[model samples]
Target: MTPPTGTPRPAQAAEAPARGSRLRKATALGLAAGLAATGIALSTEMTAGAAAQGSLPAGTQLYKDPNSQVVRWVAAHPGDSRQPIIARRIASQPQAVWFSNYSPSTVTNDVKAVTTAAAAGGQVPVLAVYEIPNRDCGGASAGGAPDLASYDAWVRNFAAGLGSGQSIVILEPDSIALTTCLSAQQQSDRFASLSRAGAAIHAAAPHAKVYMDGGHSAWNSAPEQASRLRTAGILTSADGLFTNVSNFNTTANEVNFAKNVLAALGNPGNLHAVVDTSRNGNGPAGGGAWCDPSGRAIGAYPTTNTGDPAIDAFLWVKPPGEADGCAGPAGTFLPDVAYALASAGASDPTTPPPTTAPPTTTPPTTAPPTTAPPTTAPPTTAPPTTAPPTGAACSVSYKIASAWSGGFTTDVTVRNTGSAAVNGWSLKWAFPGDQQITSAWNAKTTQSGANVTATDLGYNAAVPVGGSTGFGFQGTGSNTASPTAFTLNGTVCTVS
Candidate 1:
């Protein structure tokens, strides 16, 4: 999913293939499976537990792959300050690992290794097959096989790696949802490739459940997404659909949206859905804060225990704490952000909060900003120095809007208190405790250990004398003390 504002959309392509004869064969196999398909069978034994409506499904079985980056990090950094919380909140959970590279030669072996390990552990592996041409519309996660034939070849090899074990494949993200960016012919060819992909996977591993990308709750209307799913051969080529991968939308919202889309698809009660409940704990931050906005928390943990009959499971398609191309590169893991998300107790899995109030049960609408009177402060007359510049005279104020057990929301305002106008600014501070910023808005923010820098966006770069601009962030930690010192362009700002 695309970020709200200047954040670049992560490129979402990976490698797969298409051979005319093989495509025909795979498509035929998928069609046959669809005609003879019965709905998934539920195990008779269910673990008795009270799961939140859209949280992990009770009695559902999901596999936790041990090799995920977060899992490895927790093992290697057991002594780190953030390790304990991250290990408890994130590393322990199961998430899908993406195979985005187009390595035809090694793709099959890679798939086999994963599936083989999962089978030995009596678990089902979740695999994300992300290669598709022109993925992300040439955005940040871009790079796929050169053409359809190459993609077809890649898929065939990828499918071969399934090794007759239980697996779940999340087919290309944005491949269908973002098709409007493609020409009509491109769309048609892409759809065909997707169909071929599903067919190939099903043919290779009959036990593998394949889910096509359904965008997210906010992107396409049910009917529209359903139509696209049909055109992409979901019914004939795949088992079900998945949504909210790499995006933040409340699970409740995705549940409703997924059900509506399935209803629109008119499947005969066979198709189900999975939601990426990785980092939607506080839902979207509104105003298009898709790319790692502050104060966002981790959502429900991975589980097959979705209470809803129509929903299959809630999976962590996008691993928590991984940068979505803004804080870092698209998939680079950020420990502080991860810690903030995992520790955000706004929607604790044990006591999941209602995403929205009764009746609608959608994400709560963000409130309009309330204007506050300017604070009275003493002005400084320090001359602006270009080099070794002594600090610029400014005022900084911090406010905690909300707090939970491990999470809090803070807003910081900076005003030019000097006589001269400030052309550009950088606000810096350090957390007093283990606190980490998960998401931020109104500026470009980055964190290194406890220190953070919030740089002005173009529109907010210039602060005339007495003018002010502000940004907000959501963070996680037991201690949320206001940073004692604030700096603006090397000058210490008086805190209010």
Candidate 2:
């Protein structure tokens, strides 16, 4: 991700607008206010059965695709060590399907299949419409329908597949956030195209909740993003805004950021927000490195029960384990990376609710405290007995992820195996060969001779029992023997 310019704070925008624009804004404001105050049911024309199944009602189950990349990988490698955890944590969750390819002819059927299945299962499906021209600003995820006209046609065809079911459409990630790459005319053309795209989707499937990109918490200021969104016609064309798509920013920050953007957009109570919580469990890496940074983990599961009324749901807009072009080719799924993210997130179940609303799902069971020995005899006869403190224990897996002639990259996974949670951690190990550390991500590393130490950053400091976290580094040396031992907080750990 580009370096953050500011936090999600409100800024000013002029009230000036043309007459037509003023009328449209006023109408939207009344519609939103009426929906909130009266709890009025959405009309059949306004929403397909989507209000019940597609709008992600509280405690609603999101559709889990049986043929997702992670599911196929899990089925193929049933015996892999990471299979169980990945299958349970990553594959089982509902995530968005991207219609990123610019095939107008087949896009309809491809989308229909997913929506059809979700409709049959009485679940909501999240779809990401990303075929905008010059997508990603000519970065790794570049290329789209060539121009605005073709993009409008493609989006119309894509909308045909909503299948009268409940669906959430995340329209063109990075479309607004990365618009800096376009010239003034290009930007206007793109915005017009986006506005048309939203109109087309709603025209075809009024039930589909179309959310425009509000960028992430760290990128554009709230007012600037709101201004861009306004120009793109978010207030009329889309249901709300989505933040942190495929980016690792904290849900808390994204929530605050999204609220700020909504306020700047006029704060119609009906225009809600959803956060991409797929890979933000540990928040952003230090320095805001966006490309496949290590130690990152999965955020909250896909749930519509976001305690906050302003926030609608925590959606997994970006599938987990997809490389951001650093660890591998962009969009490539790496099982090892997926395992680390799941393992790191699996242990901690106490994710604070986004607001004061009580948790929807029951919390994980906690270990009961040990009972002290019965004091049958007088204290003078025997000293009062007490339970021993639980010591930290963990297992370390060291893998050489990639290698070359003079240098190689490695990923080390540390899993908590103790009965108690690890509040903070420090991993120390000695290299078997003359490998000198060059640089690292996820952890702060310092090497002396063959010995190396990696400590947790601010976000990744805690390790609940059975939870895992990982860090990676690049080094120079011919010798690449895996370290045989590791220590977490001074306690020796089993090697994998």
Q: How displaced is residue 484 in candidate 1, in Å?
A: 26
TM-scores of all candidate predictions against the true structure: 0.64, 0.64
The alpha-carbon deviation from the true structure for residue 135 of candidate 1, after best TM-score superposition, in angstroms, is 0.7
Residue-by-residue lDDT tens digits, candidate 1, 310-413: 88888987777666654444565556567667757354445243232222222112211211111111112222324323335899989887677897767788
In angstroms, the error of model 2 at 376 is 48
- The regions of model 2 sitting more than 4 angstroms off are 1-56, 346-496
Go through the candidates in order and give each one's C-alpha lDDT: 0.66, 0.67
**Error in Å for residue 58 of model 2:** 1.3
Q: Which pairs of residues collide in model 2?
A: 54-166
Q: What is the Cα-based TM-score of model 2? A: 0.64
How far is 69's C-alpha from truth in model 1 (Å)? 1.1
Give the CA lDDT, 0 to 100, for residue 195 in model 2.
Answer: 73
